[model samples]
Target: MKFLEELQSLKEQIKRRVQFDVPEGTKNIVIGGMGGSGIVGKIFQEMYTKMPVYTSDSYDIPDFVGDGTLFIAISYSGNTEETISSLSYAKKKGAKTIGISSGGIIEKEADVFVNVPGGLQPRSAIGYMLMPLLLSFNVVSEKDVDYAYSLLKRIDENNIKDEDIAKKIWETRRIPVIYGIPGYRSVAYRWKTQFNENAKVIAYSNFFPELNHNDTMALRDTYRKNEFFFISISGGKDSRSEKRIDITKEITKTEMEEVVAEGSSQFEKMIGLVHRGDYVTYHLAKLRGVDPTDISSIEELKRRLSKE
Candidate 1:
């Protein structure tokens, strides 16, 4: 399937195939997975800020994870070694465990299982992997999910103009440095990873106020000016962040791009920014003449790891 088709699959993927409930008396949540699957956890942690949510991309469960912790293991392929290993540790630790996967030992071992649709690349199945988990937490309403689908449908229908500019910047072979505020930091990370996996290009990401203290210092190095393209994902919620972006632009004056999000609510802003970035990454992939869906380098690394 084409990358866009996989992204569009979210229209049908929101229907949950397996159902699970968080146990009562759970005090905290810990999510474990790796790579594309792992990103779902990170996004969730950012979106559901009311609770103590931690994401682990490593092989072992964190020391803080225990019986009171609700551990969610997410692996679209159902066989990510790090996630499986973490799930095993969670079970041994007596944490309440839920597994989200297509199918694998995780499904068999989890106290409860969520079956996401198979066939699409894990990253491309963001809605499938993320929506169900968010629903479980009650952080995302059905209306929110519906709105996201409708928003994507509109974007698909209305040609994205940002694609042309993004293609031009990407074709220059300059490294992409994505920045955003607290509300849109995850979106920036998503853009960076999308470029990494889809465009097969190296990209970096950081949040505002924090980046101002250290990363802004790099602007003094004029030799690196032409080597980087600065892209900011602005949620447009904070005056401080807006000022920071303005200052950064004034300081560097490099080839900069801003993906300003429009929405009345934080959730809407986040999904909107993510939707835009996804399309930009697709265009970047097209300009590079690479299959956006293919991540052979990651597969090769996994193969090497399996042999070790």
Candidate 2:
């Protein structure tokens, strides 16, 4: 319920204005973090296309991430080890470092610290995690943001379509394969993780043009064909990608659930689609008789890693 309720706070989260100045001579951007925190970078990369933006999930900084690079570390907990390690690497390379977190070691280590609200699960804080990037980059216009927020604010938290999708996925008892177009690739990944963590089920995601070439062939394996469920997310205005999705469906002849993204702008469409998946995962957890908030396996892995 807490996670579900937090979805409504996205309007407030986007209202946060960040004060960040791009350093003189900064040529590129590298965002470092893992899981939920890192996912924001993926979303930002799609939104901000002015320059090259790279997202790193591992401990090592890329060799080119030096001098003119601006490194931003995002860790909702402020204590994620890999982010700290990457931050250290960026510093050694003479890159300017900024960290966004509720408060943790990153607060002290980063040259610039952005403190967001804490206490909620990292996955549940997407709005808080995403605001810093969105506000700083100005990739989205103020008018578009306001329009998107207004649209999102009016969403029915208990959407019946989302509930029906969840029920269909839960009843299928098959591994889910979610596909997205170029624009919605991050959303597909988010849905996969939501199912893995929230629904406690194995889920996979891939994008259209690329997957149509390779992954679609995997569907031909008759032995395992019936063991998977496919879902396609549609919304991006790319006509070529849309045709690819349609052709893939016809060629594969595999049953796929289509989820149309709702909203006027790209920002709103992405947020609304992600919100839809969040509710679907919540309902799926209920149907699966699992606690959506439970992430004991991840916690256990973190605990064991801390000991090493």
TM-score of each: 0.94, 0.96
Off by over 4 Å in 1: 14-19
In the range 102-176, model 1's lDDT, one tens digit per residue, is 888888988988888788898877767887777777776667656766766777776466587567666788888
- The global Cα lDDT (0 to 1) of model 1 is 0.81
Count steric clashes of candidate 1: 0
Clashes of each: 0, 0
- The C-alpha lDDT values of all candidates are 0.81, 0.85
lDDT of 2 by residue, 1-308 (tens): 47666666777777777647778888999999899788899999888878789999999889998889999999999999999999999999999999999999899999999889887889878888887788788776788678777766766444788888888877878888889888899999999999998999999999988897788787756768888888889785668877887888788778888888877788888888887888888889999999888999998999999999
lDDT (C-alpha) at residue 142 in model 2: 81
Clashing pairs in 1: none
- Clashing residue pairs found in predicted model 2: none
